[model samples]
Each structure stands twice: as structure tokens, then as C-alpha cells.
Target chain A: MSTTATLPGGPGRQSGQDILNLVLTVGLLPVLMAIVIIGTSLMSPYFLGWMNVVNILRMASFLAIIACGQAMVIIAGGFDLSVGAVVALASVVTAKAMAAAASAIGGPDILAIVIGIAAGLGSGLAVGLFNGLCVARLKVSGFVVTLGTMSATAGIGLLLTNGIPVYGMPKGFVQAIGRSQILGFPLAIYIALAVVLAMAFVQRRTLFGRYVYAIGGNQEAAVVSGVSIRRHLVGTYVLSGGLAATVGILLTALVGSGQASLGGDAMMLQSIAAAVIGGVSLRGGIGRVEVVAVAALFLTILGNALNLLHIDSRLQPIFLGLIMVLAVALDEFSRRRMSRV
Target chain B: MSDADLAAPAKPAAIDARGSRILQGTGWARQLALPIALVLLLAGFGLADDRVLTTYNLLNIAQQTSYLALFAMAQMVVILTRGFDLSLGPTVSMVSVAAALAMAGIGGADANGIVAVLAAIAAGFALAAACGLFNGVVVSILGVSPLVATLGSMNIAIGVATTISDGRPVQGVPAAFADLFYRGSILGLPIAIVIAILVGGVLAFVLSRTVFGRSLYIIGTNPQAAAVAGIPVKRLLVYAYVLCSALAALGALMMTARTGSGEPNLGGTLSLQSIAAAVVGGTSLAGGRGGVGSAALGALFITILSNGMNLTRIDGYVQMIVLGAIVILGVVLDRLRLDGR
Candidate 1:
């Protein structure tokens, strides 16, 4: 089997429909982002400021991180819906761990933070392991498995904290993560950028990446062709879990505490929306990490702009819904065009 | 005839006659699993708490499961066609808010109460059906995955709900409205329970007897085959979604009545809960199997689980964990049964 089966309309003889498909698939998101930026800047002076731009990137950092993991899972023919809960669980665990470590060890800060972070991430991985085992080994649909995990994880988070926020991490640690800057930008931005780049490299250059695409493209074919489908599928979910945990840790720093509902309903939905808007196909087998990063930025900027515009936060889902539908419709339009040929 | 058989590759069995007999029995086993589980749970809970199996509690369970039963049936309709309505919760929310608004605004004490209730219900159902129409067009005509498409619809519905109600419950509905629609009984049973049974009975009849319902099975099992067989796949898909959303709306009406107001924030756990109920009842996520009766039983199982836990003084968080575990266990058992066959 071919290692990289090209998507439809692979630079062959040109047709109008093919051109449209290519543009819709590849060019629409960036164009949409630029339009939003320019349009919003014209409406509000603060929208175009460097500070606001950096803030938008900073605001999107957590979502971008989660979306990167979600992108990998989607590319591998499964997706995680428990990410938002995982983030909350991770946050709570991290905060609790940090507090316990600080109290026990008298905080040189770094040691306590390190241990705390590990504990938080460990919790996340545990959740992922359960999801991965059920989805990959048991052959359960990822949707149902993750749906169950989401509720369970959220319940676990709430149980641990008694529905309250954990507080009092080391001030130094919080400052470093939440407010420390590199030159003019937040550390969160740099971290998100690093994640995006690393994921892009892994997606484009690694054998596991190739396996993911192959499995998503055709699971039976991938299995027949010597791919370790179960292992890779589980790995994708683990990656998602770990990344969501990382986001949880970041959220702890940013808020200076951990709450059971850290990311809330909108967070998971936003990550998925970002992935979809950036041209990640829900059916799997096709996506780029770089595009997903852009998609996350697009969503963040849209939300920020709307905030600046004084739009009701409650109405935000409507715009998100409309954009999501439009994006999928574009995907459909492109697929139809390719199939017609 | 079944999705599993259609999707299963031709592999020789490695089992003996006894094993084959067990495998042959798996089909009906899967059908009976949820009901049997429900019975075992009821017995267990009854043994634990005398109040758990009392007539009052039984009636309470029926009343509580009524809305969930409606939601499960809605999900089952689309699941039967290999589609999902993630928007069902939001649709319910929107319908509830709309119904509440109508009841509060249009159905004053001076107004004709019956006519006002009828008009409000008509409007509520119309909005819900429209939501389904949008989802259907996106999934069928546009060919988007049901997950992404309905997720978008969910966002839109939520937005509408929040906007219309301004994030508050529409209150002061006529007391008689709540009495008739929510608390009032027909033949010594809650009207909500009566409505739920009627809906389930009608759906069960239609699913088994109607061409439209049978077409869902064919389409879900293998869309390509159905298309080749000249089913109007796209139109039928639309109809399925519309039906699903309409049923959700009906559930929303019950919810609104029960609350004695239209609550914009309703449906927090509903979408997942409905899916959980459906899956637990033995409905296939892969589609082309299961029925309304099974889904209703699933809803009953879930409601009883919650109610029993409450009676046993289980923490709400623990209940959440158990509910999540049950969904995963249900799917795991389902997979094992399918693999056995």
C-alpha cells in the first residue's frame, strides 16, 4: 500500500471544481482569520494593538494545546470528548499536589512544582489509559468511551475538590507560569508554539504519524499492512490525555487555583471547533497540525473581537455553530467536487 | 440485516458446537441485556431499600424517566440511520425556553389556557423540527459527519436559548399549565409518563411496520447498498433528523412544564445522558439495530440507578462515576457479543 495516499485532486489536470475544492480546503481559514482581524481592527482600535494580538495568542494557548492533541486523535480515526474534563481533573490534581508538596517540603518552589505537575499529568494519563484500553483493545466506539470518561473524570475532579477550587500554590511558581514573559510575549504563547511545532514535526516526519494516517484512511488495510493499529490508536489517545493535562496545569497557573469546572462546556467544544475550522476532517485520515493551530487562533480572535464588540457571551455559541456548519459544508463541497471527477 | 453482519468480514469460526451455540444465542442476549440488567438492579435496590421499589417510587421513576425516554428515542431514530444528534440537548433547551416564553407571555390568566398551551407547544415543536431540518441538510445533503454537524446545531440552539431567555428562567407560567402538562395524571399515571408511553408505542409500531423506519436500518447498515437499491438516502436522512429533533422538543416541553418555567440552562447533562440511556438499552452506535422500547428501558434503567443511589445515600459524584462506568460497560459487553458472533 502507498505510504501517503494523496487526497482528491492531487495537482493533476485542473478543473474549476477542483480549484474550488483546493481553495476551500486549504485557503479558507487563513483568509477568514485575516478578514476577521482587519474587520475587527477597523471597528475597534484595541483590536489591532500588539498587546491585544499577544493577548489573543495567550488566551488561545490552552485551547491550541488541547486542539493539537485532539487533532492527532482525529487524524488517527478516533477523537476524545473527555478532554475538557481531563483538563479540569489535571488542574485540580496539579493544584492539590502543589499544595501538598509545598506544605511538606517547605517549597524551594521548583521541586514542589515539578512533583505537582507530574502528579497532575499522571492523573490525565490514567484517564487516557482507560479510554485507550476500551477504545483500542475492546473495540468500543471512541465516541461512547470518551463520553463516559468525560462524565467520570469530571465527577472525579469534583469529588477530589468537593466542588471547590484548590488554592495556595507557590507564588514564584504561579508567576513563572502565569505571568512570566519572554521579551514581550507570555510564556504560555511560547509553550503553545513549541507544542504546535513539535506536533507538526511528529505528524509530518514520524513513522507513528504515517501509521495514524494509514489507520484512519483504512483500518483494515493498515492492519493487513503490518501496522500496529491498537498500539498507535492508544498512543494517540495518550497524547491527547497528556496534552489536556498540560493545559490543566497551565490553567492552574493562569487562574492561581484549580476548579472542578476549569474548562467548562465551551472548552472541549471550542477545541473540536478549532480543529474542524482548520480543515481537520471528522471522518479522519486528513489534517495538518499547522492548520489546526491557525484554526485555534481564528476562534480565539473571533471570540476576542466579539468581546471587544460588546456582544453577549451567551450568544457566542451561535456564531461558533454557524462557523462550524459553514466549515463542514465547505468540506462537503470539496469532497463532492473531487468525487464528481 | 444487521450492521454487525454487514460490516463483519468473512472469517472462519474457531469455536466448537457449544461455543457456536453460545455465539448464536448472543444476538438475543444483546437484546435482553439491558432489560435483564434493569431487573437485577431493581431487585438489588429493592432489597437494599424498601422505599426503592414502592409504588410511589415506581411512579416517580416513570415520571422522571419520561423525558429521558423521549430523548433516547430521539437519539435512537438518528442512530438507526448511522447519525447522531449532539444538538438534542441544546434543542431541548431551546424548546424549553421558547415554550416557557410562550406560556409566560401569551398564556396569561385572562387568556384561553388550553388554546395558549396548544399554541405554545406548536411553536416549540416547530422550532425543534427546524433545528433538525438544519442538521439533516448539513449531514445528508452536505455530507458532513453527524457528530460535527449536530455539534454545530447544538451551539446554535444553545445560543438561541440563552439569547431568548437572557440566561434566566422564564417564570410565572400559569399554574394550571404545569399541572396539566407536568403533574396531572391520566389513569393514575403522570401525564408525562403517559405521553412517553404513547410516543414509545407509536415509534415502536412505526419502526417495525413502516417503510421509512425500515429504510433507516438499510441506510445505516450500508449507505452505498441502500443508494444502489434506490432509496432516497438524503431525504430519508433529513426526515430521521427532523423526527429526532421533534422528539427532543417534546421532551423539552415536558421539562419546561415540570420546572414550571422555561429554563435556558436546562440540558446540561442531557445530550450525554440520552446517549448513555440509548447505548445501555442496547442500541448500536454503529446503527441498523435496536428499538424505541429498548431505549425506553435504558432510560428507565438509568433513572432507577440514579433514584436508587439517591435513596441509598450515595454521593452525587459517586453516582456520576457509576453512570459513566455503566455506559462504558454496556458498550464493552456489546462489543464482546458482536465479536463472539
Candidate 2:
């Protein structure tokens, strides 16, 4: 377990460690999925159908999009409880914008889609900025600050529409974005995959990514080394917000309506769980985007398998919770083992 | 020139002393601020709304606050030792639901309600204590970070709670137990309030006057130093978690009594609010500070905020926003005090 006893500089290079960790983390997801597939196939002949696989991918897409941002935030040494709320806000804002646009301009689908994306990004940035200010300037703990933002955003969403679900999106907009597919795959899944790949690239190749890891590894050291800790911190949160908004929009497209209350709540816990399960250290400074993406898939598959097994929907969260704890416990144990050796 | 230089030197000394005095005063005030705020807020609300001052309303507030106060104190104890109990809320819910179910099975009101209640409380404490122990073992012995360890436990606890309740609220609490909450007022004060006050006072004594309490502060300030000084760091951490859970169990009892039912989501708000109250009362998340008196006061302040909003007929969503703002404000004030230190 101890890396120290190995030949000096033998196996500790950045690429080697990254590859090893990535393989281990990403490999687990497929193994879990295969197991689920096999088990479910034995129980029901329709388990391995292409449609079922597509269904799983579609469900995983929205959560995976959100998890990408969450992975970054955790790696940057902060948590964002308000991502869910941001999603809800974004969804509602987009719905209203689309409705208004359709009424005024006879339904320009492209314009409405662009407007939705812009709204999602703007709303996310606003909340992220508020959170960053409170955390950095006011020097509040990230946990408390984010929690406040979470509540406030939820309130904002409720107030905007009096807690009613917003409907009547442009029909063309829904058809093009929500139900459209390319090469037998959902557009949302492809979008999520692209985002995940981009995140992975940023984490591996960008100076900004290095800065994030440096700050998470040691704040004072990063500051002394001339990193703009405040700017980068705020940027990370803004990015998280934007990604959450994207997830929200995708969810709206899938459902063909905007229901603020339900959409955001589950994402908060799920994103966090997925990040942790993927080997992201809650203490920050270590994690991989690919791992988190895999984790999102693992969770989705598990839920899908359980549903197929006729397990109660209510018990799903409980099972997910248990798995989350187990993952962290294992991570903790491995970390300790590595440190001791 | 010699006289002026001498006077300037004296001025610097005077300023230094005054600065130190201010720091000390802020520390002292910070400790008492939450309690003072609680009292003042209650009084202000009582004045603004005549009904707020009435015995009925006051008792009602007390009853509502007791459950939160218990959870807050539990959170305070763990945080004082530089740990967290994310599982506290779920533990309470799980125990309350189990108790309610047990009572329902035991012929409603007359089927040995006392034993069933005690058993439920014990089960809650035992479960919470075990979680704390798991966290302690991982954190203190295995060198896992508290944030990661507890986040994992939070998920597991939530899962267990959900599984136990099967996603349904447990109704049909024993009549006698319900009456103890709804009808058992003494001298116009709710019995629950008396229980909370008693719990607060007793815990206050234990925390302030006992050797174990002092040791917890030592552990919180510097775990390595405490371990070196033979403070039994692992044991104390476990103890802190156990006490936190036990108190949460007591809170569960009161909550069950008051609501006359137990829901899986019973303690959702309590988790964050308890931490908020503890922090507002000057219990630093960094650990090694604060007392139960301030925590109780913090709880009272929160209650006042909610109750006042209710009386004013403030929009529920706006009230949530206000509460979030208050939390941020409290954290900001705390940060300022810490920076001065």
C-alpha cells in the first residue's frame, strides 16, 4: 500500500498514477454494469435489449452532466449544495423564455434553444458569484454558504411561479431538443459525453486545471505560488453552476415541462455521491473526470437494475446511500493504507 | 522632538493594549451573541405580534424548538471535538419512525408506551453512536478526514432510515405519548420546553465543568497535540459522536410526541439548522469552542425568525430567503471575529 517503499521515482510519475487510477475507477463501472446485465438477463430475457441500454444512457446523461461540474468543485476543495436549485431555476427560466418567444415570434426553435442555454448560463453564474462572494469575501465556510444559496434559490424558483409547474413550451423546441436523436442515440447523451470529455481534457491539460489541483492540495502554498485563489475559486463554482443548468435544461427537454421543485432535489445528493464513489477526495486535490462519469453510470445502472428486480422505488435512495458510504469508507481505508506505507 | 517622540511611543503602547482588549471583548461577546440574539429576537417578535407573547404561542414555539435544540446540542458536542455528524438527522428520523411503528403495534396508547418510547430512544442512540464510532475509528485511528467520513455516514444513515420507514410516514402514535406533547403543559409551558431546558442545562454543566469536556476542547484545537498529551483522542471522539446521537434520539422522542407521527423526512431541516445554531452560538466548525447555552439561544433565534415570519404573513418562499440570509450573516459575523483573533 505504501508508495514510499517502491524504487525512488519508479511508479510515482503523474501519467502513470493517473493512468492507473483512471483504469481502476473507470473499469469498475463496466464491470458493475456487466454484472447487472448478466443478473437481469438471467431473471428476464429482455434485460439486454438495445432499447433498455439506450434508456439507461438517457437517464445517466442528465446526472452525468451535473456530475462533471460537481467533480470539478470537489477537486477544487468546495461543495455546491445549490446546484440543484440552480437547475430548477434554469429550467423554469428557460421554459418561460421559450413560451414567450413562441407567442411573440411564431416559434423560432433555434432562438428559443439559444435563449434557454443563455438563461441557464446566466442564472448559474449569478448564483455561483453570490456563493463565491459569501465564501471568499465574507470568509464563511463553504458548507454554510452553499446551504444558504440552496435555500434561497429554491425560494426564488417557488416564488417565480407560485410553486406551479411551468408548461407550454414551443412544440418545435421540444421536438428538436428533447426527443431528437442521431444514429440511434439521444442528443442529450451525446452532449453529456462531449461535456465529460471536455472536462477530462481540461483537468489533464489546462493550466487552470493545474491551478485547481494546486489550490486544493495546499491553499497557502498555491497563494504563495502566485495563483489567483479567489478568481479561480469563483470560476470553478460558475462552471459548476453552468453545468448544473445544462442538466436542468436537458431534464426540461426530457419531461417537456418545467417542474422546479422535484428536478433539483435529487441531483444534489446524487452528484455528490457519484463524485465520491468515483474516488474524488472530499478533502479535495484528487479525482478524475472520467471516474466521476463512470460513477454516474454505475449509479444509474444500479437504479435501473433494482427497478427491474421489482424493488420498491422508495428503497432506491437508501441503497444508493449505503453504496455512497461504502465507497467513501473504502477510499478512506485506501488513503490511510497509502499514507502508512 | 524628544518629548513628542516619547508621547508617540506611549500612544502606541496604549493602542496595543486597547486592541488586545477589543479582541478579548469580541471573543466574550461572540460566545454570548447567539443567546442574546435569541432573547432579543423573541422579545421583538412578541412585541410586534401580540399573539407571539401569549402563553399558548410561546409554549408552541418551545415545543417546536426542543427537538431542534436537542439535535443542535448533539451537533455542538461533535463539532466541539472537531468532528461532524451528518447522520444525526437521519438517525432521529429512523428512531422516531421505528418508535411510532412499535407503538402502533402495541395497542396504540395503553400498550406499555413508556417502555416502547425508551426502547426507541435507545435504538436511536445506539445507532447514532455506532455511526460516530465508525467515523471516529476512520478519522482518529485510520487518518480519514472528518468531512469525507461523515458525508459517507450521512448517506448510510439516510438509507437505513428510508429502508426502515419504507418511504411512508408512521402514523398512529400512542395516545398517551401524543398527549404528553399536545396536552401536558405545566404552568402554561410545554413539557417539551422543560425537557429541552433540562437537557441544555445538564449538558452545559457536563461540557463546561467536566474534565472530559476540557479534553474535547484540547482535541479539537489540535488532535496531534492532544494525542501526544495522552488525551485518548480516539475514545473522546467516539464519546462525542455517541453523546450527539443520544441527544438526537431524545429529540426524536419529542418530535414524535409533538407530531403524533414519524416521517422519513422528519429531520431533513434539522441537520442544517442544528449546525447553523451551533455555529451562530459561537461553536466554531474549526472546533474547540462554544457551549450548550448559546446553542439553545441560537435555536430560539431561528424559531423566532420562523414564528415572526408566520405572524407577519410573509410569503413562505421569501421567509426561506430571509432565513438563508440570516445564516450567511451569522457566518460572516463569526468569520470577522475569528479574523480579529
Candidate 3:
């Protein structure tokens, strides 16, 4: 079994202070968001408009939902590069299911949605389990294992569709899930919020959540304490995969079609960025679902503000990339400073 | 003499230690399970399609493998040092464009074109080195995890490449330059393939023979131990990253010359595929082990897979799925070997 590699100080003395620091560090995301809001509102009237704000929220919702699972994986000291690929594959599966349901069940709206969600979650669960088996049983690095899964899942998507886009998804389905607003708020936004809250509850109140933190903090310690490393690791990835699938389903609903190539290739990076920006340690064992949700929303707002300001669309990637780098750089600096003390 | 004193003979101690060393050395072969699987796949494909082994198809595979082989070597070095350079793909694309533009700037003479190409190489080295330096400084000195640091760099590199080209392809390199890459051959083999072999060979030698190379393995295996032992851990890591990016630039040059144009998307799959090749070839993501030569072979295997799949008229999209599956299988097998250890 691996032992905790101590660095001068033990965990007991610093754990309380570390928790306080994490709280303050994670709070920075929401603070930044407030600044962005005030600045954007001051700069452009359109920025403050309810419509634009709602649009940003809706966009952030998709990413936030996915990041919820991502947070869990990071907490477990693992990564899921296959999330984007899973989304792509899940979207295709959902579309195919919807079409079949429509033909057999007289417009398979509800049934199709249910089946699509289940299929997406199931695929994700399988992939997660596979990744877990590799990492826990086989001892492969999470980074490489998930990366392999990423490529294979993407291949599955292509093979299933022959690279063709699946179109003519039911419009009603799209409206209800993707575009419909209840009480002046987008359904997707509400869904994202609900997911975030649920994740927060799980992370704070559940034994499994505590196990995730323990594993990330020190795998050896967790194992010695009798935590089922394999089961928990698999569960974390399964949650991540399932969330990714949910995002895919939402994306399909929004677009009313499924394209094998539609999901973001940059998603893995973006999810990591959001988590880091929200103060999730890449070293693992620390982070909050709420922080990631805020970070995702902040990024969406930044993108929206840039778009409204007539910035070229192509530059968006560059700016976001810069932000990601800076975020990590800042995190590193802070971590070192904290550790030094 | 006491029974304990007689039982523990000093003479046999050295023999036992040497035996363990030999056992550890041979341990590398167990890592070859993935590469062996890849070979089986190639054999399977060769039997399924006669065209897979045709000289023309084989040559095609070699040419394609050359590009990724360079990439795999680059990735291997970085991974060996326990870091990654996600900016590699974009760095390659950018270098490719710079080389083509440099050629155009130098007019049409072969000598001048060659000079331009070297200058482009220098530029690529310089640029990639800077990115690597940034990552190294942030990760090693600032204490950021490799995943976050490199993920950010990947985005920035891609953005920089696209921005430099204004999202347009750069075409019309000097005819001689293109001819050198596209037409030059030795004994019916492409010059690019020859260069790739040389690069792979030299890198393998460096990894095995050089102090800097040995240091990389030590640092990767245990950074704290390496640092405590007085190794310049940060500097070595930075150099590894620089070497990785510089090689990626070389790949870009070859790709640009082959296409006679610079496309922003040239290295889109390079990062993932190169990493896959390295993993499949027995490079441990956990660090401290692997060879560039194995990575070269892994790249060749991937190239063969692509070529054979093409010959069979498997849709390009489906091929992606297969590639992904291969990557996952590679990692899984690698994990199994590690677990055995």
C-alpha cells in the first residue's frame, strides 16, 4: 500500500486552515462574476438585458451539468477525457432511439427521452467502469486511460452514424427540454441549478463524497482505512459519464439533431479549466460543485460579453485558453504560497 | 559462528542484488503487450486485405507514420519527464505555416528554401520552447499539475496558430521545398520516413545514453527524491518539454511540405494520437520508463491501422472509433502489466 508522503507538516494541524483557505479561494469565482457583471453592464446596455443574461445562463447550464460529474472525478484524483466523446456518442444514440420510438410509439417523445437519457447514462457507466478497472485493478494512470476511452467513444459515434448527422428530431422535444422557459427561466438553466445543488448535497452529506476526497487526498490512506477504491473510483467516473450524457441529450434537444462531430472537442480542456478556475485542485481532494458551476457561468458570460462587443468569433478560443492558463498559474502560485507556510 | 551470521552470507548479497536488477530490466518486455497486440492487428489486417501489404500501401503507411512518429517521440520525452505538452499539435501547425511562409519569403531557390526551412525550425524551437518554459515554470516552480498547465497551453497554441493564419490556409510554398518533402526518396523510400527513423533512433540513443535523459527518468519516477538528490528537476523538465515541442515543430514542417500548404487543423489529432502511440509502445504515464523506439513502432502500428482501414473502405469516421478502441485497449493492457508488478 502507498503511504502518505509527508512534507514537514502532518494533515491534522493544517486541515482546518486548508478548509478555510479553500472556501476563500473558491469564493473568488463568484467575486469575479460580480465584477464581470458590473463591468459588462457599464460597458453595454445589451449586456444587462434579461434576454442576454438568460442566454448566458442557458449556455452555462449545459457546461455546469457536465462539470458536476467532472468535479467528482477530480476529487477522486482521476480525469475523464472521454466525456466529450461520450456526449457525441450519446447524442447519436438518443437520436436513433427517438426515431425508433417515434415510429413504434406514435411520436416517441417521452419514451424516447427516457430511453435516450438511460442509454447515455448506461454508456457512460460502462466506460467509467472500464476506466476504473484499468486504473484500480490494472494500475494505469487515469490520464492515459481516459484519453484512450475518449478516442474509442468518438470512434463509436462515427461508426454508428457513418459520420452522417441524424436530423428531424421532434421539435416538441427540443422546445420542452432545451428552449422552453418556465416562469421566465429556461428549463435547461433550472436543470443545471438542480444538478449543482444535488451534487453539493452529495459532496457535503454523503459517505461516498467523503471517500472521494479521502482518495484524492491520499489513496494509500483511504485504502488502509478500508475504502473500496475500485468501487468509488468507478462510481465517480460513472457519475461523470452520466452527466456528460445528460449534457449530450440537452445538446441534441437544443439542436434538434445529432451530429457525430457536433460535441466540443475542446470540452475536456474546458471542463478542467472551469474546475480549476473555480479553485478545484488538479492535485485533487479539494473543490466544490457550486464553485465549478459559478466558474462555468462566469465563462459563459465572458464569452457572451465578448460576442456582444463584436469581437471576432475566432479569438474566443484564444481568450478562453489564456484564461485557463492564467487560472492554473494562479492556482499553482497560491498552492505553493499556502504550502510554504 | 552463529546460525544467523552464517545464513546471511555477504558474498551472495551482490548476486541477489544483481539478479533483481536483471529482473527489473526484463520487466520492460511485459509492457510490450500492447505493441504485440498492435502487431497482431496489423497481421490480421494484412491477411484480410492483400492491399495492406502491397509496396505502395506500405510506403503510404511509412509516410504517414513518419509524421506521427516524430510526434510520438516528442510526447514520449515529455511524458518520460512526468509532464505533457498539450500545445504540441498547435505548435506543429504553427511551425508548418511559418515554414511555408518563410519559404515564400525566401523566393524559389532550393538553397534559400532550405535556409528558410531551417529558420522556420529555429522559430518553431524558439516558440515551442517558450511555451514549454512557461508550462515548466508554472508546473515545477509554481506547483501546478501537468494536466492543467498543458491543457491551457493546448488551447493557447491552437489559438495562436489560427490567429497567425487568420483562420485561412497558407499555400504556395516554393516548388523545391514541396518536392523535397513530397518527391525526395532514398532507395524507393520517402526522405521523410528516413528522417523520422533517424530522429527516432537518435532520441532513443539519447534516452538510453545521456545524463540528461537518465535524470528525466529519475525525476519522473520521484520528483521529491530527485530534487533532494540535487538534480535540477525543474530545469530538466523544462528541457524535456522544449524537446517535445521542437519535435512537434519538425512534424509540422514535414506535414506542411507534404501538403504544400499550412492548415490550422493539421495537427488536430497529433496530441492524442502521439500520446496513444507512446502509451501503446510501453511508455508509462506514471513516468520513469519507456523508449522512443517503441513509440516509433507504435506510431507505425497506428499508421498501418489507418492505411489498412482505408484500403478496406472502412469509413474514415468508423476508423476513428477503432483508433479509440485501440487506445483504450493499449492502456488497459499496460495497466494489467503494472498491476502484475
In angstroms, how far off is B259's CA in candidate 1? 1.3
| Tens-place lDDT digits, model 2, residues A1-341 | 34533536554575676664654445445555677768887986555689988998998888888888888888888888888999898888888777777667765577766776677678877888888777666767887788888888888888888888888787776787789999999899899989999999999899889899998889899999999988888878888888988877887887888767755657887888888888888888999988898899888888888888898775676577656766676566656555676
For every candidate, how close is chain A to the native chain A in TM-score? 0.92, 0.89, 0.88
Candidate 1, A226: how far from true, in Å? 0.3
Q: Give DockQ: model 1.
A: 0.79
TM-score of each: 0.93, 0.88, 0.89
- Misplaced by over 4 Å in model 2 are A1-34, A105-107, B1-48, B108-124, B127-144, B179-182, B185-188
Tens-digit per-residue lDDT, B153-189, candidate 2: 6766677777778778988776677766555777767
DockQ of each: 0.79, 0.47, 0.59
RMSD of 2: 7.0
Q: List the residue pairs that clash in candidate 1.
A: none
- Pairs that clash in candidate 3: A102-A108, A151-B324, A152-B324, A155-B321
lDDT of 1 by residue, A247-332 (tens): 99988898899889897567998989988888888888999988898899899999999999889999988998998989888877
Lowest-scoring 10 consecutive residues by lDDT in candidate 2 chain A? A1-10
Which of the two, 1 or 3, has more lDDT?
1
Q: Cα miss at A54, model 2 (Å)? A: 1.1
Badly placed stretches (over 4 Å) of model 3 are A1-28, A107-109, A168-171, B1-39, B108-115, B180-182, B186-188
Q: TM-score of chain B, per candidate?
A: 0.91, 0.85, 0.88
What does candidate 3's lDDT look like per residue over B1-341, in tens digits? 11111112224465346435534644645645555766787788888988887788777887889888899889988887777777777778777766666666665555546676666566666776777777777667767777777777777777777877788888757766666666688887898988888887787657765778767867877889889989998888878877887788777777887888878888787888888888877677878666766677778778888888888888876777677777767777666655554
- Each prediction's RMSD over C-alphas, in Å, is 5.3, 7.0, 7.1
